[model samples]
Target: MTLGFGEGRAFGYAGCNRYFSGYTLRGNRLDLGTPGSTKRYCEGEGGEVERAFLPLLAHPFILQREGEHMRLIASDGTRLEFEAAAMESRYP
Candidate 1:
């Protein structure tokens, strides 16, 4: 799948949360700004956890790939891993 620039794009969830992040290859850092969370007040079991997690993404990240797994290692020793696979999308 084409991940595009992996930054400077608006990514959203169905719950209405949007994130704005940027990538800088020079310092090998992916930075996210003040990410605005969804305020529609749709509280679910995981709503509080999701809201808390989104704001914690303000730190920088370093992307590492191992096979199909893309790991976003943050500066604080936190790693967000995403598995890359062929999904049915417009590009496919």
Candidate 2:
């Protein structure tokens, strides 16, 4: 299953590692594509998490939005956790 977040809703991770994939609905499933990222890396705190973060987003995530958080879980047991920010978003 996929997710539908709607238009004008920009998505990114905790540390401003943003993505350019727009959200759309195809029937009951949401289609996500065109994921682009910046080559820069953060070397400080949560860096390992950051390192783990990007590579884990290899495929389009099946998403679900909660009251405040968006939970993204993959089939490989890799879970990407992003706190819901009023100005930011994340998915795996």
Candidate 3:
């Protein structure tokens, strides 16, 4: 999974589909609006992943960063971690 933030928006490839939402950050708390995604039906593991992952975005989460790693901790104590990816230029 990949997530990117820019211009008060959050967007990413959410396992089976691309998703986008408006976001607000206050200190370490991050809140995201309802996400919009392409209507694509995925099967098997992808489908299971999508179902489990998308709902996590609905609730606000605490953001933590350490070096190249970032973690999002939900109110229920569920944590999701991500590492920074190599930057790729959009124009080449």
Candidate that scores best on lDDT = 3
Order the candidate numbers by TM-score, best to worst.
Answer: 3, 1, 2
Question: Candidate 2: where are CA atoms >4 Å away?
Answer: 1-10, 14-16, 22-34, 88-92
**TM-score top scorer:** 3
Candidates' RMSD to native: 5.1, 5.6, 3.2
lDDT of each: 0.53, 0.51, 0.82
Over 4 Å off in model 1, which ranges?
Answer: 1-7, 14-16, 22-27, 85-92
Model 1 C-alpha lDDT per residue in residues 39-80, reported as the tens digit of each score: 556477456656656765677778787898777787778877
TM-score per candidate, chains pooled? 0.60, 0.53, 0.89
Please give, for residues 1-92, the per-residue lDDT of candidate 3 as tens digits.
Answer: 76778766787777888888889989999998878887799998887888888888999999999998989999999998889986322211
Per-residue alpha-carbon lDDT of model 2 for 2-22, expressed as tens digits? 222435433464343545555
User: Taking the candidates one at a time, how many backbone clashes does each contain?
Assistant: 0, 0, 0
Count clashing pairs, candidate 2: 0
Give the winner by TM-score: 1 or 3. 3
Tell me model 1's lDDT, rounded to 2 decimals.
0.53
